[model samples]
Target: MLEKIKNNFNTQTWVLIPIAIAINIAIGQLVLVLKLPVFLDSIGTVLVAVLCGPWAGALTGALSNTIWGIAIDPSAFPWWPVAAMIGYMAGRMAQWGFFKSWWKVVVTGFVVAITAAIVSTPIAVYLFGGITASGSSFITAYLLQTGQGIWSAVVSTSFLTEPVDKITTAMLAFAIVQGLPRRTIGGYPKPEQVEVEGGEGEGGANNTQMYIAIGVVVLLVLFAAFMLRNILGG
Candidate 1:
C-alpha cells in the first residue's frame, strides 16, 4: 500500500501539485468575485486526481483551501477536509476508469459531488449552524425556515447545488486533458488514466464533447439564476 501510494508521485506530479493548487485558488476567488452560486473551485483537484493520483490530488485540495483560507478568509479553513475528499473521490473514480468518456465523466462528477455533500454536511451543521458564508447557504436558510433540521437543510442544499458544480468541474478537467498535447501529458504520473479509450481522435467527436461541456455550463448558469431568483425573491 505504501509502495502503491509512493508510486503515484514523481518529479512531474510534484510539479503539477502547486499549479493545481493555484488553479483552485484562482478560480475559487474568481467565482466569489463574480458572486457565482457554484464554487467551481475543485477543477484543479479533479485534474490532478486524473493525471497524477488521489493522494496528490488530496494534497492539492487541502492545501488549496488552507492557503486560500489563511490568505483570504479564515472561514474557508474549516472546509479543507471536504476539499480533500473531493480530490480523493475524483482520483478513485479515475482509477475505476470513470474518467474516459463524457458520460462516465459525468457519473464521476455526480459521485464526487455526492461525496462532497456528505462530507460537508456535518461541518456545515456543527461549525456554521448550517449557515455557511457560501451563497448556497441561502438555500439552506430557506429549507431551515421551512421547518427542516440543520442537517437536513444543509444536506438538501448540497444535494441541489453540488452536482452542477462538480459535474462541470470534471467535464472541464477532462476537456483540458483532451486539449493538451500527448507529449506534455506523458510527463504526468498516470497519463494512461486519461488516454481516450477508443478513436475519439476524430474531430467531430471531440467537437461534440466540447459542445456538451459547454451546454452543461450554460444550463448550470441558467439553473443557478433560477435558483437565486427564487431564493432571494422569497
Candidate 2:
C-alpha cells in the first residue's frame, strides 16, 4: 500500500497538485460568486486524478478545500471529504479505463456525483442544517420548505446538482488532457489511463475525443444555466 501510494507521486505530480489546487479555488470562487447552483470546483481534482493516480488526486482535493476554506470561504472547510472522494473515484474510474473515451468519462462523472452526494449528505445535514453557503442550498431550502426531511432534501439537492457539475468537470479535464502534448502527458504517472480509444496512443484520436468533450461541456453548461435560473426564479 505504501509503495502504491509512493508511485503515484513524482516531480510532475507534485508540481501539478499546487496548480490544480489553485484551479479548484479560482473556478470555485467564481462559481460561488455567480451564485450558480453548480459547483465547477473539482475540474482540477479530476485532472490530477486522471494524469497522476488516486492518492495524488485525493491529496489535491483535500488540500484544495482546506486552502479554499481558510483563504476564501470558511464554509468550505467541512466538505473536504467530499472533494477527496471525488478525486479518488475519478482516479479509480480512469484506472478502469473510463477516461479513455467521452462516454466513459460521463459515466465516471455520474458515479463521482453519486459518491459526492452520499458523502456530503451527512455533512450538510449535521453541520449546516441542509442549508449551507452553496447556491444549491436554494434547492435544499425549497425542498425543506415543502416539508421534506433534512436528509432527504440535502441528498436530493446534491443528486440534482452534482451530476451536471461533475460531468462537466470530468469532460473538461478529459479535454485538457487531450489537448496536452503527447510528450507532456508521458511525464505523468498514469498517462496510459488517458490514451484515447481508436488512436491506440496517438494524438489524432485524442483530438477528436477532446472536441467532443468540449461540445458536451458547452451543452452541460447551458443546461446548468437553465436549471439555475429555474431554481433561483422559483
Candidate 3:
C-alpha cells in the first residue's frame, strides 16, 4: 500500500499540487463572492485525481481548503474533510478507469458527489447545525423551517448541490486532460486513467461524448431548478 501510494508522487505530481491548490482557492473564492449555489472549487482537485493518484488528490483537496480558510476565508476551514473526500473519491474512480471517457467521467463525478454528500452530512449537522456558510445552506434553512430534520435537510441540500458542481468539475477536468498533448500527459502517474478508449486518431467520439455530457448538464440544471422551486414554493 505504501508503495502504491509512493508510486503516485513524482516531480510532475509535486508541481501540480500547488497549482491545483491555487486553482481551487481562486475558483472557490470567486464562487463565494458571487454567492453561486454550485461550488466550482474542485475542478483542480479532480484534475489532480485523474492525473496523479488518490492520496495526492486528497492532499491537494485538504490543503486547498486549509489555505483558503486560513488566508482567504475562515469558513472554508471546517469543510476540509469534504474536500479531501472529494479528491480521494475522484482519484479512486479514476483508478478504477472511470475517467477514460466523458460519459465515464460523469459517472465518476456522480460517485464523488455522493461521497461528498455522505462525508459532509455529519459536518454540516454537528459542526454548523445543518447550515454552513455555503449558498446551498439557504435550501437547508428552508427545509428546516418546513420542519424537516437537520440531518435530512443537510443531506438533501448536498444531494441537490453537490452533483451539479462535481459533475461539472469532472467534465472540465476531463476536457483539460483530453486537450493536453500525449507526451505532456504521459508524465502523470495515471495517464492511462484518462485515455480515450475507443479511437485516438479519430475525433468524432470525443465530440459526441462531450455533447452528451453537455446535454446531461442541462438536464441536471433544469432538474435542480425545478426541485428548488417546488421545495421552496411548497
How high is each candidate's TM-score?
Answer: 0.89, 0.85, 0.94
lDDT score for residue 91 of model 3: 93
Best by TM-score: 3
Clashing pairs in 2: none
Model 3 agreement with the true structure over 1-234: per-residue lDDT tens digits: 999899889999999999999988788778879987667998898899889999999989999999888998788899899899999999999889898877888899899999999999999889987888867788999999999999899999888888888998898888888888999999999888887777556443367878998899889989989999999999
Higher-TM-score candidate of 1 and 2: 1
Taken over the whole model, the C-alpha lDDT of each candidate is 0.85, 0.86, 0.88
Alpha-carbon RMSD of each model: 2.5, 3.2, 1.7
As a whole number from 0 to 100, the lDDT of residue 47 in candidate 1 is: 92
- Candidate 3 Cα errors over 4 Å, as ranges: 30-36, 200-205
Tens digit of per-residue lDDT, candidate 1, span 1-234: 898788779999888888988898888888879986677898999999999888888888899889888998888899999999999999999999888878778889989999999999999888888898877777888888878888887887887788888988898898888889999999988888887776536432266766776677678667866875775577
Is candidate 1 or 3 superior in TM-score?
Answer: 3
Model 2 — TM-score against the truth?
0.85
Best model number under lDDT: 3
Tens digit of lDDT per residue, candidate 2, span 139-180? 889888878888888987787778888987888787788889
lDDT (C-alpha) at residue 17 in model 2: 97
> What are the clash counts of all predictions, listed in order?
0, 0, 0
